[model samples]
Target chain A: MASGSARSCLEEAAALGSAPPVSYEESTMPPVDRSVVADLALFAGLGPAELDEVLREARSIRYPKDSAVFHQGAEADAFFVLLHGHLRVEKTTPQGQQIVVRYVSPGEIFGVAQALALKHYPATAVAAVDSIALCWPSAAWPRLTSKFPSLAANALQTVGSRLQDTQARVIEMSSEQVEQRVAHALLRLANQAGRKIETGVEIDFPISRQDVAEMTGTTLHTVSRILSAWEQRGLVEGGRQRIVLRDPHKLFALAEGRVPSERSGG
Target chain B: MASGSARSCLEEAAALGSAPPVSYEESTMPPVDRSVVADLALFAGLGPAELDEVLREARSIRYPKDSAVFHQGAEADAFFVLLHGHLRVEKTTPQGQQIVVRYVSPGEIFGVAQALALKHYPATAVAAVDSIALCWPSAAWPRLTSKFPSLAANALQTVGSRLQDTQARVIEMSSEQVEQRVAHALLRLANQAGRKIETGVEIDFPISRQDVAEMTGTTLHTVSRILSAWEQRGLVEGGRQRIVLRDPHKLFALAEGRVPSERSGG
Candidate 1:
């Protein structure tokens, strides 16, 4: 059943192709406040003048939900920092299957293929929600790095850790059972975007079971069934486009392939 | 049958744990030549004097095939650049399943956790073949970067590209069928380590079917069966710990889910 649903999901994804091209409109928006740039991890240690120089030619842009910020094969002209809302980094395979690679959180950088001197964006960046971002033209990368060397170092660190995380995800997909994979995927999402709710920690964005299925490389039916089972076991609470971890510790153990009895007794 | 074999492989990997602690024997090895550093992509633009400064405190070390260079979770005291032979970067999941993350080619840098200021190695590095490398103590990172700023920038670019590649692999694992995944994996390995042979391009290292299975998150039986079928089809030649792609174009088409008939007709 899981494989059948996964095939159908892939078919749907193939039909979807790419998200509709993003529509850009001129904005009367003021420049992003330097304070925000100073607070960003990328520019944390930059002096006031350094931050000013880095933002001198920067522009603020807004993208509506479900719109492409940039396409995978398009020229990489600018790099972005998410100021508000969410963005999804995705790659469409040669076979036309769309995969969610990762999500860009507030203050995080995206479209960094330019930083690596790549001519084209390796993946598409789509706005998961109505989003605002500070954009710097690719031409400014060298100047910014020269002035603030820490910026380059910080970016490397971010990229390194991200590589480690991606490899871990590959391991999970290859070695873990579907239930364990779902558990691990949820814990990761919670770490990235979880918010405290009255009952538990909620993923602070709209995400359907289909999205979870896509992220975990499983099927919507499988994810729905697992989440329903977890709900019955008092491990998680689920509703329309929302999931709250009622007991994160148990989920963590499950992700490690430990049964509840083994976890409790051991 | 495939799942059963995969389960047994996982059991064996769990028993293996981390590569037996890397036993470093004292050697009369000399410092790496400055010219070698000049040739590396990471140090491409460094002047001879700058290269010398970078290697001032470096040491050369050798590891026999299958020996550990560094274990996952161990303190990262140094960063390394492969001088000869290949290394495999692997990560063990919480469930004790080992996944081959990536292969390190000569002149490529590995064990870069220290460069990212990470306290422990995120993955284990094992010599896939008898290998030699230049190792630098982590304490010198700041001074080295301060002297040659390009070193840091170059490292960032390397890490960025690697992160993109890892994400691409994750997508393949998630969305591609096992046959497609295996084809893609073999193609990647060929590109990285291929050597012109009498009949075709051969992966220039000792890599078992079991290794390929681990790399693709499948089973030995599955990999063996696929290889045997490809062998019969004249697309590849498989032998003990060796594989030669007799027809790369067909394999490439298969990886993209194109049948030979469709590909030739189109």
Candidate 2:
């Protein structure tokens, strides 16, 4: 349903924008397909007419790899739904340290601070790879929610689940060791973006040791040392920017702070 | 509108329960006042009829200090709206470490895992003080949302803000030092639960140094040392189960990882 031509039009539009060197040619962009809209669980159970109404207001845009889709503190004029590729949401401290909050996968929504009545984006969203997203103006939300109550319901559910996940991450950071934290972070990422490979499950992204360190709240050297230890134990394979989880069960045991033998014996 | 007799009835009913030793008697409980429903921001836009509909299905109950309103992993049959006092949401790791996720102030909602369609509570909610809450069955959610869309919208907004706050906490834990983390944590608590005192603003709950240490992912010794250091500098005053922020500006500067003089100079 998503075409290269549509993406090209979006890129051209993004190019016209002064901020982020992106342009947005609204009139020249192609409308999102109804099938694509239907595929999103957020819009499930909506009638075809409602789906058409949504697509009428939707504009698909493409962002080049490593380019910011939106910056922190920018006005939340619109919200986005990822259609393809990955996005990393990050927040920067006053001292300029960037912290990766989480990654967005296809079919997930982001830039939704407006839905919460927030006037600005809470974090920056950057394209981890060349990515496509369907965007809707914040003003259109109330009408859309009234027309399709499921959209509001689904969005609420998504926000609720994310809150629980973030709280869990807080608990992990507060109580777990760095090694266990790294293991848990990898397991979560793998669950979200893993693809089966000859070795095991690859994360299917170009995530480096530094990125892992950021995610786990540890130093790069510590992440490198842990990965090296895991590689030696055949629990994971890492090279350059790629990581393959060779033994997820062992990693799970480590994340639970238990010896692999203890898990196996049990 | 919350009567002592109604609280007694609820307590008698809770006593009949097999789980937690808390008591409550539903039979003698007085119907919740519609005015009370109107007072909650979550139900702000609803008409009197809708408010009555909500009250018809609501039960107001009391929780004594240190009592658990619900346990982690318990069936999430109902969601609650705090009417008075405070509640602390906590999660226990597998290694038996309890992490304080967040605290719920009056007029806020908690035990809302059911709103996400989760079968069980993701965290335990305990009474940080003698608390009162109005509860509604999870099954009542759909009807409530459909009748009063603002309820769903408001709840979503609340969850969204909490998610952002939690992510901010994760960022702090990952990037800031323990001292900065402690300062930020106390400042946040002060914002939410601070009460004016003769010297400074006191956190309006009986929170211990151990609680602060758990919140900042540090040891009790570290928290004590930092608080003592701050006391010496006239930044904060601490006593048995109490903390009063003597110099919020200084704490704010510290939280930003800057000295007080630098902030004043800027």
Candidate 3:
């Protein structure tokens, strides 16, 4: 189903109608737009000249917070590299339970299904915040690969890392308790999306207790109770939609199958 | 951990300070020995010359039954496209239970972790039977992509389908009964690896009932009992080491959360 939209592109291409548009060098194309390529891991190490080349073939887009970049099962005609803000990858079960699969931050690439041989997206990706991204038509990957070997290597590394993360989630879901899952999820978010303050590491995103509950496969009541208990002991401090980790070591302990000491957050 | 092995390549590339390899048309390079462009759904319409250019850069290999093409935690340096025979992709739990995530057949690709961003294989892939496949060095994808736009489109479609399959499996594991899981697994295996014979369709691989038990998260005793019952009812015929599906429609009904007939296989 993810390929539904992309399929149209193929159908269009096959019927011998509208050929794909090709962009010329920077001098001929739109002004060198380094902002997009600068924030992408794939193009990180490239020189300005190389970045310009990549940008020549890419288009910049702005998405409002909560907008969908790609719906699960839609045709994927292009691959995206996040230039700003965050995106959430999610899937919904037949029972209608939404599982937040993972998050994509600035400098990361999404919609890699474009390079894998599938035409559809396996999950829906929504802008978690106001976002800017660079898009390369799926038609460009092969030409890009042949022209820039680093791009392919970068793509491989991206896919490999994602697979490891997914495998970790599967392992966690299969063996870890919901409490432990919550601890791990929070720790991960802090590591990836956390901002440091005088208090502790604060997750950059505006996640609620309910969001945490859903991520950990538990009810909101359980997450609230657990967080409240932790707050009473000073392990965390949460109020007005903010969470600060008071003790990362203790949280790590909980995530590693150990019993954590009481919270210190007040 | 999938990219752990590939890290060697990365380190080597870094040490050499050599530019990344790109392009599939270097006349100095060997002929296309392996290419997914032809078999891949996304690249279905490329001209013969484009296909040949891809083939020149590909390499083929054979894997014996029970051998692993890649191990979990290993570096993912290449993506594979299976040409013939069956392969089982699985993850091992801390408790040592083997979870057969999926089985792949000819024309399908695996080891795609190389493309996702992580460098490790999240699971192990073993040949369920003697198998032949083509391998594309992870380094080659970038150039291939830029040179042959359709390759990316094909890959994207493939990833989408795989994601859907994995999602379905995850849902079944969470909600389906063991019997239903077993039935579904059997049906899946039959579709991917079964061979039509005069009597019925036989699973192309040499899988034991115990293997099915593990795949279904059930006990061997349970699988044995169920198979015995199915045999008596003529829905299936179980031999010492093989099972033939006599009535796939009935099996499908069982897999769909329905009760099987008392007169089923033996």
Candidate 4:
């Protein structure tokens, strides 16, 4: 991924670290700390022994920023729980168009294709930042789930939220204006990974206009124009693959279809 | 639903047909035969005692066509497994625009907001036709899933498939042409509920052009225009809420973004 300049985006992402591949028994891999995962939603009710059992079959690895943990259509032989940092899940349409499906936060269990009866990954998962994850072989899915029904319940909860979120986006794409959709997308990212700053809440990651376009079913030019207008109005600060909501309440009002307040409160 | 012509669409949907509401303990509700659900994917390997235990907590109820099993934003106190007929899950956006999320076929579980950790249903579920479902109270969710881990696994599988389906639609909506999205939506419906006929496969349900528009994130006018063109081209037969695919293979090709072939095979 670091060296291939000519590779397609997904292909470039696929050639990187995922997890131990029958080669880590001799390596000096540090033991995972239980405290790191005990509070995760996926392991909500899991005890120390349960966490140990779950982690026993897992291997920890770090993926560099912009590298793919798994490419779309690759064999889905493993599932993962992110221990740190962020991830972006992207899907490429059959017609060679790439869409940013969603972003993954830490403590989330992802890439469980076998749970979906899928043999291949449906999307490419890229590390948004340098990220560490504990991955278990797909074969362990049934046994682990059977032994810990809470895992299945938690997974169900996770998938349910995603389905609802995706459907919400579809509704927006269908009925809302492009400006409102972009506003909503920004709000979602901010809600997920916002960091408080003197100006406002920053998305806490590097996200390009192109990524915003893919996420909102709009064009990069349109997103650029909208963001520029918002920037000019001092509603947001944007540049260098970074976005900060300077007036988040105003953005929220815009997202709700309220008229753009010409009276700047800030 | 049968009498209200002035009510909001979602409100109109909220007026009838969920499971027992503290009044059916003495009513003449028929017992749900175990044979009907024994082979369903949900209860894959439950023993007789487990089945009896689950059924004891469930209530079976029939909903008439055009009625709602539950409304969006209602307290999500119960979950359901459809035993007969089709259901349409629809979400009304904050802007009050209705979007058809997906259709539910027999043997599918729906409205498990408790599993998703939501206190209210995010979408309204309507009986696309006369349908029957076995519903369990939300309180039973944790207990039942814990007691029967396979139920949780199966539910995860179901939710996983839905999440994938919704994400696929998002990818299509983000990148595909309206015609392509419409084609994909139709193909999905046909795949899910198509019944083989002498000439071709029929959707086997009353699906209006408005429904198609909602499902594909388009307008009724647009859907009507597109369907009419396909009808004239001898690709499909549409009338009276019935859609028969006269040339499904051709339609499949169209959905896949292939150049529409003018040469008819039939």
Candidate 5:
């Protein structure tokens, strides 16, 4: 190596002292100890001492499938991070219509409303599958934010992103036809938590026809009828709780407002 | 004062070599500033130094009445805080149908699309009237957030609130009737940006009949017909670019999907 490169390497070594080499990926992995604060998105750049302080106050929990992790209007006193498995965010209208807001996968966060205003959960989050999560009480937020400003900033950006998504959804509901809305919802679900199979992508969740209808803001009868039609056309395959896209291109065509009958041959 | 207490105070002061004279207000101002940050719901619990940094970087601008700030799909780079006046957020469908998204007032934010995934503005924001605003560049976001974690956390919370609002709007559009929607929209506008005057609470913005119609996802003709009927009943005073509510309580009754003709009777 050139002398300049060697000098920089020596400086880096001096700065780090003599510690075992750690890769970036390794650092992202959840810490084994319950109280060892891992570098979260909000606290990514914090010093080790500060992280230790956070970790001391952090707790971990495991949630089984179909668990009611939290309910809407409950006092928000903690934030959660999904270490593994899935979480579903949903809301119910006064008319008793259940709407699926979105799904949270690993590395994403839930119960962020605790940090927001109203100090209550705005939506209900359920453990879609057995999940591991990290919890930090709201009391620690002020101290954590003070010690790690970058974390707070990143959190804002994430919230901003969610706001934009919500706005787009509003636009869709106001403007797009129901069929297009359904298409968009399916595309979003696939993007968020789909598993790639040899035939096509499958949304990795035990979603029912009613769940799909609620998500698309359509009737259960309508959803079942449409799915049955698509199944006949070989666009998708559904059996019991599983839904697999056999031909996404055809589904895309339907989403763009083309009649399923017209595209049957294709 | 007790003699022992006075003596102990003097001794402690003398020990510190002439303690600095402190004003109660001045001493508390820092935390008060922190509370103010918290009030913004986008900077809850921000440290004094970080807030000072944000205040230093903020730029103020004035928007003339009815001027378009950012159109949909314009490159997004900054988010704005309304210092004064009102703004109308709207979107146009592919078929050229205009839909009112929301009316923003003082102390609220606009152009938050910069915080989301879009590189472009998602909607059109028009100054409903003469407006003063503070702008924060997206470039400054990273630095501001990194320096002030609470600010970032608050930003996330703000986004969450927006998401919840949008979700509600979607639910309304998907299920509610046009007339009901019009009443709801009017009520929301009155609450958010209307001025309570002797005549009634007039929408504190230069909104047209067409604007109201679009907001409710109805035709201008239909809105005009509805208003004309309401006017004859002495429920409202409708003028070019102005509408005065003669009785807010009665208007609210109408908004609740009730036939309030008797309330507006002679």
Candidate 6:
């Protein structure tokens, strides 16, 4: 972990050993700044003192790039806020298939098993890049939210937003064919993490074709075949772990059924 | 509508027109009983006085069998709890295919647009049977939740539970074959609303092949064909909208991949 000021309240809590959930690697990390999460939707409506109180209960841990934060079926005893960087949340089905549930962006709260009334984490969370997270014991959820009504209100909004996203994905998967679903997934990704390039919006992150396949509920081979077809049509430029949409409108037309599917078959 | 006591506080609120969203049909209906919702999870932490306060804001309406309580794209200005009976919640895709999102039973909440931060209802909610719902204006959500933190806390659990349900469906839809997916869907429905028969458990409410198709993310033709095969194998009995699982364990084995799929060339 990066060096910081001094041993903070989190260290003191770890020494007390009241909760094993939030205690990560021992470090003399500086105390969290109230300003860090002040603007996040999770902390909205909180006063400065209230924010400070919540932050005091948090312990910071640095996750190296591509490291597993938690695994499926592990005891879900903590909740976290991404202080910086991205996380990939995936669920492995009993048949050993992996599905990308969602990617957590910075300022978002996740691993919230308490909200789900679940005793174990349903999916695995991994750091997509080197990341920092502020975590608190799941036991603190009820106490803090009870004392601060706004916390519960904010949590409701967060869970509600995620439910809506999941519903939308379900609808898309149920109603559309494979290529159209993939197109919709890509458009959504661009909307979420796009960077403006000279020609078109390029997805800024280094995301693999396997990630795309997982997101759209298809095999990697199918994704490769579709991307190749799109590349031939000059619709999207696909390289290793990179994708740039050269003609987003055309893809949208195909996805929305305004135009015929260009790929014959895989 | 059923007649009860004289016009009460809800009538007065409707007369004032402060919120038009919950101004249902005028009726001399008796006020809601505190005991009716006192044990409900939503009102779990509330005192009798607080429950009364929340109930006072609700306007009751009786929806006849097969009537719509609300439609997709309608202004989402109200939230509801089922006082009695069941509801079928569905969403139509851009391509006009309908998907059954869920079936809401008595004592459960629905149509809380405030929780989703949505301006309109995302799905159509129809009465699967003659139903009564007590609705509050969406404008009151923040106010009531602010005053009663447990309301927001309970709402979090509700939305989180739905998210997990949706996630489970997404995984099933992505990873499983049609017969297995349909089996899982039926097993879940039976678990939710089944009535014990001599040899099997029957889904108590009337449900159609189309509804099963919608729930399992398959075509109606596919569902019919699969059901016919199951009937022939003595696994289930289907007549009109009724279904009885003659050997639920066999279906469960198929769904969980404990046994090989029996349907061939459907």
4 or 5: which has the higher DockQ?
Answer: 4
Please report the TM-score between candidate 1 and the true structure: 0.85
| Candidate 2 residue-wise lDDT, A2-65, digit = tens | 1123333234334434345333544444477788768787888888887888878777888878
On residues B110-138, what C-alpha lDDT tens digit does candidate 3 reach at each position? 77774675477778888877887777677
Q: Give the least accurate 10-residue stretch of model 2 chain B, judged by summed lDDT.
A: B1-10
Instruction: State the displacement of the C-alpha of residue A115, model 4, in Å, after optimal TM-score superposition.
Output: 1.9
- The DockQ scores of all candidates, in the order shown, are 0.57, 0.73, 0.19, 0.74, 0.35, 0.71
Q: What DockQ does predicted model 4 obtain?
A: 0.74
| Residue B109, candidate 6: C-alpha displacement in angstroms | 0.7
Determine which window of 10 residues in candidate 3 chain A has minimal summed lDDT: A1-10
lDDT of 5 by residue, B1-266 (tens): 01111112123224334557665633343322233333564555655666666765555566777776667776776777777788888887665667788888787767766555468787788778887766666667667766655556656666667677777776666666666666677778888877889988888777788988777666789888878887887877799988877777777777665664435664
Best by DockQ: 4
**lDDT, candidate 6, B1-266, per-residue tens:** 12223332244456646655543433434357787777888889888888898987787777777777777887887888988888889998877889999999888999987667889889988888788888888889989987888788888888888889999999988888899999999998888888899979998778999999999888889999999989998889999988999999899998997676563544
Poorest 10 consecutive residues of model 3 chain B by lDDT?
A: B1-10
Name the best candidate (by TM-score). Answer: 6
Off by over 4 Å in 4: A1-30, A260-266, B1-30, B260-266
Tens-digit lDDT track for model 1 on A1-266? 01111112122233334536422321323345698777888887888886777776677677777777777887887788889888877778776777778888898987878778799999887777788888777777877876678888888877877887888888889998889989988998899888988888999888889888888888899999999989988999999989999899889988888784224575
**Is model 2 an incorrect, acceptable, medium or high docking prediction?**
medium
Q: Model 6: DockQ against the native?
A: 0.71
| Candidate 3 wrong stretches, greater than 4 Å | A1-32, A56-61, A75-79, A112-121, A135-153, A213-244, A258-266, B1-64, B67-84, B93-97, B107-122, B130-164, B174-183, B197-200, B213-247, B250-266
Cα RMSD of all models vs. native, in order, equals 9.9, 6.2, 9.0, 5.8, 15.9, 5.4
Question: Could you tell me every candidate's TM-score relative to the true structure?
Answer: 0.85, 0.88, 0.68, 0.88, 0.76, 0.89
- Which prediction has more favorable lDDT, 1 or 2? 2
DockQ-based class of model 6? medium
TM-score of candidate 2 to 2 decimals: 0.88
Which consecutive 10 residues in model 1 chain A have the weakest lDDT in total? A1-10
